[model samples]
Target: MAALLDSVRAFFAPKNDDAFLIDRENPSDVVARECLLDRAMGVGRRKKSSEALRRNRVPAEGLALVARDTSGHVIGTVRLWHIDAGITPEGNAVPALLLGPLAVDADHAGKGIGGALMRAAILEARKHGHGAILLVGDAPYYERFGFTTEKTATLVMPGPSARERFLALELRDGWLEGAAGVLTASGAKMLEAPLKKAA
Candidate 1:
């Protein structure tokens, strides 16, 4: 019996040191992700500048991801949205992704799940050909993942935002260099107008 239990541990432990697995977010994870975000970030998070860019826009393809435990319950979530990070000094638009609302279930705090989700999301973004990613987050926390305040200093947010919290990571060298102006949503809109009632 002890040998059999050891075999089980060996099979699963190497894959994820934690009991959680990171997967692309599916339709089913939406509700759980929202509840988890609310519990972790509070109801007031919707007012943040990041939320403004995310509102009515969909995440970049395969860039929305969630972390699920062995039981298949979403315990963490992270998403990257298409955005105009800013404008180049040459009067050209700089394209980048917006990473935000990354949250872990309150009960699952301290499990390193958020970091895992960040890594997974960044990997997916790179694989999909994104050049850079921007976010409003703690410098120390995101810096470890290659995010830096230096890259976003000249960029602006559509709504109010703290300069210190605006962070960025360039997947390609010089991606954010000379980037200026306000960030804007450049993703596919969820809707152009509210659906009309049946006549």
Candidate 2:
């Protein structure tokens, strides 16, 4: 049991990679970022509820980001999608952002790279006037970044998800107040190229 306990501790421990840099994802990084995500989230990741929202939808401009090592290989990635928080009391859709698939390569896990990516994404979201951000993640891990169940208690995803893992962070106070119902894609459809098969 000692070995198992050690592994568990290691999983939660932060492993910092000081040589890494975070920046906006560029066109050339697509293949690397997709590979990194597939490695981190596994092949089944394409079926997640977040995937449903992101499929065929372009990420909000300037919000898709990547973390790269000194060698320029993509090591981490996070993208935010434009979504509507259903309809509001006034019958207009509330604009919001959906955060997802924040993936870090397994070899780079335990480092604070994930946290750094989260901070950068949030900062960019706020700077662009995004009011709220929704994601499905561990409440314990994400709570430190101001994401909580308090404002998301009434919000629902388009598909199945653990209620507690469904979370939100308000960039503008009261952005989610009185909001309820299914989250829907609200951006222009994107034309994604088919991922090339790996050798």
Per-residue lDDT value at 164 in model 2: 94
**Against the correct fold, how does model 1 do in TM-score?**
0.88
lDDT of each: 0.84, 0.84
Q: Which has the greatest TM-score? A: 1
TM-score of each: 0.88, 0.86
Please state the error at residue 100 of candidate 2 in Å: 0.9
In candidate 1, what are the lDDT values of residues 1-199, reduced to their tens digit? Answer: 2322232232222445457767778888888988988889999989998999999999998788777788899988899999998788789999899998899887777877788788777777777789999999998999999998898888999999889999999999999888899999999988676788998
lDDT of 2 by residue, 49-97 (tens): 8888999989998788887776788889999999998777777788999
Candidate 2 versus the native: TM-score? 0.86
